[model samples]
Target: MKREKLNEMKMKFRALSSNEGFARIVTTAFIMPYSPTVEELADIKTAVSEAVTNAIVHGYRSNGDKYVSLTAVMYSDGSLTVSISDKGCGIPDIHKAMEPLFTTDAENERTGMGFSIMETFTDKLRVVSRVGEGTRVTMTKRLSVFSK
Candidate 1:
């Protein structure tokens, strides 16, 4: 489909585990205007939750002082892209991190499937991280007339 920008928004909030729910709710609201299907809404919410949780728990190490940012863009063809970012300790290996059950913090019972989960729910997933800098996870899902 030809891509044309329809709507977009960016938000930054404190990186606190408590804010994870807020992130999920905000993302749902952000895309609700498009009249997404129940499954699409659930998928988006879960993806947002996983990304935000990773930012607060793993990215900031639960510091509660740093911040996590989220951005959403809608294209004319019924596609949506969501970007979740954090400016905390960055990932050392993007590949290994994407592996299932590979948790950097094993003591916390992390499943190490955050990346995979996001990838499964979204049509496309891209992760960029730099040590001591931060991580940005962007996922795209198609939600347009043709999809219906």
Candidate 2:
């Protein structure tokens, strides 16, 4: 069955490392009424952090002038969908990029596990990108313990 969207939020911000935490905090606040379990909250926050960090660090390469957009939707079925996008250098190979420990920024000691962690924590993960354009990562999770 299709789930109706209960609420949504969209925000665009400079692709600064500091905004990663801001994104997570806003996301958490958005879902507070849902009463998600501690584990679920942690999972969502971690996944958001990874995606936002990737946009700032890898997508924009810390240039900070570019923008990253975050969109979140809450569904009637106790599910949340969050998408983070950046207008920066896109991934050349998404398949390889999603591979565990496969990082393009080894020089910066990046673990290359951002996608992996996001996948592990979310119920669904989708990534779209163009080589010279940008990348968008969307993740969803069902909040089984949420208050209806």
Candidate 3:
């Protein structure tokens, strides 16, 4: 589906644990004007949380200085694309990392289902990572209109 883009907002913030909630709230508020369904809204929010959490807990994995950036764009087709990026240690094996029960920090109570959950909730989920560079998670979801 192709539609004209409406608006876009991108921001970079400190990769603090506290900012996870901030990501979710801003995502919800940003897409509110599109009148997304309750389910769609929840799905987007969950996806954002997982991506941001992964960057903070897995990507950086240390108490140091780093920034996580989030970019969101709204299309005329009622679809949104969100890209979450981190300049922390990148995943060595993206395929292995995306497995249902894979976690580098199991001792930290990580569920290891972040990627799977994101895929389930979004129309498309893509991850690109380099050993020394960083990782970027991009997701897109089409919001269906209410037909009541």
- Per-prediction tally of clashes: 0, 0, 1
The prediction achieving the highest TM-score against the true structure is 2
Error of 2 at 57 (Å): 0.8
Q: Candidate 1 on 1-148: residue-level lDDT in tens?
A: 5788888989999988889999988889888888988998888899999999999998999998898999999888889999999998999989999998899888888888888889999999999999999999999999855365
Better of 1 and 2 by lDDT: 2
Would you list the rank order by lDDT, best first?
A: 2, 3, 1
Evaluated at residue 36, the lDDT of candidate 2 is: 88
Better of 2 and 3 by TM-score: 2
| Cα lDDT computed for each candidate against the true fold | 0.90, 0.94, 0.92
What is the C-alpha lDDT profile of model 2 across 1-148, one tens digit per residue? 6789999999999988889899999999999898888999999999999999999998999988889999999998888999999989999999999999999889999998999999999999999999889999999999986544
Candidate rank order under TM-score: 2, 1, 3
TM-scores of all predicted structures? 0.95, 0.96, 0.95
Higher TM-score: candidate 1 or 2? 2
| lDDT (C-alpha) at residue 124 in model 3 | 99
The superposed Cα distance between candidate 1 and the true structure at residue 132, in angstroms, equals 0.8
Model 3, stretches more than 4 Å misplaced?
Answer: 62-64, 146-148
What is the C-alpha lDDT profile of model 3 across 85-130, one tens digit per residue?
A: 9998999999999999899888888989999999999999999999
For candidate 1, which ten residues in a row score worst on lDDT?
Answer: 139-148
lDDT of 2: 0.94
Per-model C-alpha RMSD: 1.3, 1.4, 1.8
Superposed by TM-score, candidate 2 places the C-alpha of residue 12 at a distance from the truth, in angstroms, of 0.6
